[model samples]
Target: MRFQWLLIIPFFCLLTACSSSQVHWRDISSNAVQASAAEEPLSLCRELYKDEAQIYQCEVEMSALLRARQQCEKDTDPSYCVLMAEYTWRHYKDHVLEDSPDIKQAGNYPVMCGYKENQITPCSLTK
Candidate 1:
């Protein structure tokens, strides 16, 4: 009985550790752009303009996109994760920020992916 209990304790500890380390979508995306100075970083600007309806729509779309990406990755397809992430970022840039020309233009300008102060239009330009 004592031995069985000891075995269960290790299993439970392992389960807790695994759950604690499970990275979420927000964390993954934040990590992806950890050093980016891109306009509307982490989709934060949406909150500033969201009316109730707009807020709901944004919430649903963003949540679905993140969940889909996370689920796809969990299914062992990292390509799907990458695709969904890019899709989500573009959606925000095109639809949500479209009304704000300034934001749109900022997004159009190039920004660094993993470094601060490297976000300049010419820096992002590709020949």
Candidate 2:
């Protein structure tokens, strides 16, 4: 029984060691995603509209995009930031008129943390 317990302890220890690899996976994948996710929103007005009326219309839509850009900056997650920014811009262009719906200032910011030694460290995990 004593020998069996000794073996069992090492087996359990190995299990924990293997689980630590999950952390590396998370760090790499999230970082990779974050790196790949960076993209600026498509300009609401591809080129400057020469006419005053056209420029004003373009600016209105641009406001939504600007708000989306601001919201994207607040998140640490790359994919989510892209999704929210793109969604707000697309939604505003498709549904809302001018600046009716402020989709930019929505959604909660979630935090992801890592451990060192025995302490928890707060981190920006994006989305």
Candidate 3:
């Protein structure tokens, strides 16, 4: 009986050690904001695989990205279209930042994805 108890204790300890260690998204985002408030550098370790979309600005950007990707899904090669659209968006964001540093935007909506326009001009040259 004592031997069985010893075996179970070690087995439980091993199970606990092997548990998944996924970080909470809120922890990442909340910490970034908190760090900013404290005038501290972000405490997150990217090595832990934090989701970029968790950041407030990133969350905003993701809305546009997801919208663009969803619209692109109608294309014959949806996945490819989405990939290209994302690439274009990143470049477009960089372009806008270079041209108008004051513009706070989450990339222009993908016109190539058949999106006519967002009321928010974002970084598009049309504005």
Candidate 4:
């Protein structure tokens, strides 16, 4: 009986350790989806702003906004990313209106800005 208990204890410990090391499928899938979505807004911004300087700025801003959004999602604090997304969206909108009035008139700014619900969603993943 003593030997059996010893074996069971080790087995239970091993099981716990193994389970802890296992990756959660839901987490993996969610990460993939989020990563894909994050790429979309950045790509759209890149394509929309042909100017090298403008594209660089857009990329930097988009990256920062996406990172903030991801952190917000993880922390359950929507303020940071939400504000960043809104600000980024507005900044791009103003930039387009100022530089390319035709694009703004055609309602292309939103499409080019690539955000939804004031959040940076992956434009590529979105249809």
Number of backbone collisions per candidate: 0, 3, 0, 2
The residue ranges of model 4 lying beyond 4 angstroms of the native Cα positions read 1-41, 84-127
Q: Please state the error at residue 63 of candidate 2 in Å.
A: 1.5
Q: How do the residues 1-127 of candidate 1 rate in per-residue lDDT, one tens digit apiece?
A: 7799989999999899765532233434543333234453335425432455444344333443343443344333345444544554556557766452232343342221212223322222312
How much lDDT does each candidate structure score? 0.42, 0.41, 0.46, 0.46
Q: Which lDDT tens digits does candidate 4 get at residues 6-94?
A: 88999999889765522222223334345446636546554445676655555544544444455445322355434544455556646
Candidate 4 global TM-score: 0.33
Q: Candidate 4, which ten residues in sequence have the lowest lDDT sum?
A: 21-30
Candidate 2 per-residue lDDT, tens place, 70-101, comes to 44454445345544455444554457545433
For candidate 4, give the lDDT of residue 3.
86
TM-score of 1: 0.27
**Among all candidates shown, the one with the greatest TM-score:** 3
Residue 16 in candidate 1, Cα distance off native in Å: 51
RMSD of 4: 17.3
* Order of candidate numbers by TM-score, starting with the best: 3, 4, 2, 1
Stretches off by above 4 angstroms in model 1 are 1-48, 81-127
Estimate the TM-score of every prediction.
0.27, 0.32, 0.38, 0.33
Residue pairs in candidate 1 whose N, alpha carbon or C atoms collide under 3 angstroms: none
